[model samples]
Target: MTPELLRARIKGGEPLMDLDLRQLVLTPGDYAGAVFMRCDLRGVNLAGVDLRDSQFIRCQLQDTIWDGAQLDQCVFHGSNASGARMRAASIKEMNWSDSQAIGMDMSEAQWVSVNFVKTDMTDVCLKGASLKQVSFTECAWGKADMSGTRQEQVLYMYGDLTQALLQDAHWDGVVCVESDLSGQDFHGQTLQRCQLTECRLEGCNFQDALLEQTNFKGAFMRGAKLINARASRAMFVYADLQEAHCQGGRYTQSLWADACLDHADLSGADLTQSILHRTRCNGASFMNAELEYADFSYADVSRADFRGSRFMRTQFHRALIAGTRWGNKAGVLEKDPLLFEAEQWSAGRPTAPRAGY
Candidate 1:
């Protein structure tokens, strides 16, 4: 279909369906409010065109170019736009559900309140894009490059973001629940109040990042690097951090209940007022760490190093300290037999005989 014909049909309120518009160089025209059903638009270039409020249902848009196009309020349901390029497009309030957008280039695009539900956007380039209130539900975003992207209130639920490049991305209030973000690099990024619950973040690098008040509950962060990260008030309940390097990180008031930190290095970390109830910190190093007012009740610290650590007002009640090293001492709890006593003393164990013996 030629650009003039397409414009004339749209202006005439006629739907363009079942047409083969392959390799068509659509001129810069206003094709807003057009309905394109079952159309073959493969390799078509719609650069600098105005396609606002357009509906593309079950269309084949393979390798199509939409660079710098206006796609506000557009809906693309069940359409295949694989390898399509929409770079620097103004895409607002766009709904693209159940579409195949694999390898699509949307770099530097301005997206607001856009939804991409159940779409295959794998390896899509969204670098330097500005996204506000954007949601990507159940989408396959594996290896997608979102580096340097600025996002606000972005919801990424149940998406496969494995090996995705998000380095230097500025996130604010971003919630990524149940997403597979394993092995992704977020090094030195500032993620304030971000919720990444139940996500797979194993082998990911978060070194020197500011993750204040971030919720990572039930996340698989094994072997993840968090060295020098500022993660105050963060939650990691039931999460796995085994063998993870967290040396010199500030984790004040963080919760690690039932989490696994076995063989993890936490040397010089400030864990004051943090909770570690029932957590496994076996063979973990806490040398010179500030553990004042921290709770480790019922936690297993077997063979863990606490030498030169400050533990004032720290709770270690019912914790297993076998082979654990303290400053200038090792396994020397013989002097304090009452150290094994529970916080609540058992009844019927009279200290100075019954009052009415």
Candidate 2:
């Protein structure tokens, strides 16, 4: 059908079905309340168009351009939008389920209350976009670019965002549960109140990042780089951080209960007020680190290095200190006067100075 006829049909509240509108330029048109079923709109240019309340089912939108268009309350199911460009579009209350949007460009777009379910948006570019109340369920966004994007109340569940770019993105109240974010780079980013529980963050780079109240419970962050990062009040319960590099990082008031940090390098890290209860830090290095007010109760610190580390009020009660090196000295806890005194005090034994006669 011609574009004029399509517009007239849409104006008359008629649904356009089984139409082959491929390679058509429908710029500056209004297709509100349109219902497109099994339509082929490949390589079509719908720039500056209004497609509100539209329903696209099993449509072919490959290489289509919807730049600067309004797609509010739109539903796109089982559509293939590979290589499509929708830059600077206003997409609110949109539902895009079972869609393949590979290599799509949605840069600088505004998305509000958008739900993407079972969608494959691999290598999609959403740079500098504004996303609020957006939810992605069972989606695959591998290598997608979300740099400089602003997100609020965003949730990603059972999805794969592996190798995705999130540099300089401002995130608030963002939760990514049971997602695979492996090898993703979050260097120098500031994440506040974010939860990445049960996520696969193996080998991910969080160097120099500032994370406040961020939770990584049950996460597999082995070999991850957190050098010089500030992770205050963060939770890493049951996390596997083996061989991870956290040198010079400030993990104050953080919780690592029941977590594994074997062979992890935490040298020069400020772990003051942090809890390592039942955590395994075997062969880990804490040289020159500030462990003041840090708790290591029941933790396995065997063969760990604590040279030059400040231990004011640091608790090692019931902790395994076998073969541990403490400030240029290597021996059992019985030989170390400082450790022995702390242990004695922890056991309710009086170690105070004797009163003068």
Candidate 3:
């Protein structure tokens, strides 16, 4: 059934079945409480219309326009709506599961209590939108624009958000477990109590972002850029952050226990009162980085590079340090009693220091 046929049927009180309304134009129309399952409404113009409580199951609505439309309690399951326009629309309690909606624009829209489970929303634009209680499970949002979007209780569990733009986006209680967010742009974004466990965050830029109490456990963050990021009491336990760039980032009482940070760059980073127990930092660079009262107990510093790094009371207990560079820093190398006894400095021996003193 086509759109005209469906409209005629609605006028004549008839039922629609398996309608193929591809490229239909229904602009400024009232389609409230309509049931349109398995329809092909591609390239349709549904602008400024009322589509409340409508059902669009398994529909192909690619390149469709629904700008300034009202879609309350609507269901769009398994739909392919790529290149669609839904700007400034009111979408409350909508279901869009397992759908592909790439490159769609929904700027300044109001999305409340919407469920977008397992959807591929790559390159979609939702800038300056109002999202409340929105749930997204196992979705791919790579290169998506979420700048200046305001959201609360948004769920993004196991989602791949690599290279997505989230600049100046404000999120509250966002859950992102096992997601790959490598090389994503998160400049000036504010996260409150966000959880990012087991995610791949290599080369991610978080410049001047506010990450209060963020949880980043077991994440692989090699060469990530977090310059000027404000993190207070952030937890990064068991994380593999080899060669990460954390320049000028602020950390107060941060926890990085058992982290593998080999060859990581922390130039000019403020790690005051931080705790790093049992960390493996072989070949890590901390040039001009603040280490005031930071604990490094039971850490493996073998082949690590801490040249030109500031250290005050930075403990190094039982740390292996073969060929490690410690440039002009006064610190104690506490040896464990259970390890082998320290040998004396013998002249003309293989294990002797140079006689340049």
lDDT of each: 0.90, 0.89, 0.80
**If both were scored by TM-score, which would come out higher, candidate 1 or candidate 2?**
1
- Identify the candidate with maximal TM-score: 1
The order by descending TM-score is 1, 2, 3
Instruction: Give one digit per residue, the lDDT tens place, for model 2 in 112-141.
Output: 999999999899999999999999999888
Candidate 2 shows a clash count of 0
Q: Write the per-residue lDDT of candidate 1 for residues 216-324, one digit (tens) a residue.
A: 9999999999999999999989999999999999999999999999999999999999999999999999999988888888899999999988876688777899999
Taking all chains together, each candidate's TM-score versus the true structure is 0.87, 0.86, 0.78
- Clashes in candidate 3: how many? 2
What candidate 1 gets wrong by more than 4 Å, as runs, is: 1-5, 23-29, 328-357
As a TM-score, model 1 comes out at 0.87
With candidate 2 superimposed using the best TM-score fit, by how many Å does residue 190's alpha carbon deviate from the native? 1.9
lDDT of 3 by residue, 311-351 (tens): 77776766777877888777543543333233332333486
Model 2 scores a TM of 0.86
